[model samples]
Target: MKKSYCPIDTFINVVKGKRKATIILHLFQGDKRYNELAKLLPDISERMLTKQLKELEEDGIIDRKAYPEVPPRVEYSLTDLGKEIHPYLKGMFRGGILFEKRIDESL
Candidate 1:
């Protein structure tokens, strides 16, 4: 991740990708396979999901383990850094809910 003067900017830069935060949230629940994540996030295209996962791995937020099997199995789980950021992400999730509620109420 690029260094930023503000810590918040650094944090935002780490997760600034389509469904990246959502993917982390799901992985926070437990280790998940590629297909499991795909099911959890139906709106994201396979290509986008793959890209996001690769980026997250590169950023040291998530670990991808590949198992040698007939079809090849891969699982994703949060790294120590990823777990450390959970509360912050959770707070953002809550804030998003609040804004969404306001939007719905206004409509």
Candidate 2:
């Protein structure tokens, strides 16, 4: 398939999944274990969660660290690139809240 022509399309491609944005937002709070993430997004199915995490990791938006221990442990955190996008996400969030409020008032 052809690559995206627009910059926003490229960004959207990286975080296209339903849970991807929420995952990134949660990681903004702090690094989280696999189970922790699952807990944070209780509505997501395990299969879907695994898929989105893999996509994020492949896109270099998140880092996955596995610890060598009795019980395998995995943690996910944002990369430098991911951190760089935080301000943009925050801006989108504020705008979204205002947009929602406006819609509510209009209804």
Candidate 3:
């Protein structure tokens, strides 16, 4: 089947996945290394994390910088466009917390 990459669906494509948003949410705190990101989001496979990072970089939502050292180091952080979405992400997080509380209360 052919997948449609519509303009309206582009944002969802980038931000609506488990690993993708998890990566973005954590990085809101600061830059993160590959292993640090993997540890922070332990459920994600390293391959998935790598793929998501590349996608985000291609979309200009995140920047990856590699430093030369004995073992080499790479860190990922939000780009200006990514920072623009942080407020929305914060609100989403707050809303999710409230929704979970409501579910707990009902249970």
| Highest lDDT model number | 1
Give the Å shift of residue 78 in candidate 1.
0.5
List the pairs of residues colliding in candidate 1.
none
**lDDT (10s digit) by residue, model 1, range 1-67:** 7889999999999998999999999999999999999999999999999999999999999999999
Best by TM-score: 1
**Candidate 3, residues 9-72: lDDT per residue as tens digits?**
6666668765787788888889999999999988888888898899888888899999998699
Task: Tell me the spans in candidate 2 whose CA falls farther than 4 Å from its real position.
Answer: 1-3
TM-score head-to-head 1 vs 2, winner: 1
Better of 1 and 3 by TM-score: 1
Taking all chains together, each candidate's TM-score versus the true structure is 0.97, 0.89, 0.81
TM-score, cand. 1 vs. native: 0.97
After superposition, candidate 3 runs with Cα above 4 Å error:
1-9
Model 2 vs. true fold: TM: 0.89
Q: In model 1, how large is the Cα lDDT of residue 65?
A: 99
C-alpha displacement of 90 in model 1, angstroms?
A: 0.4
> How displaced is residue 50 in candidate 2, in Å?
0.8
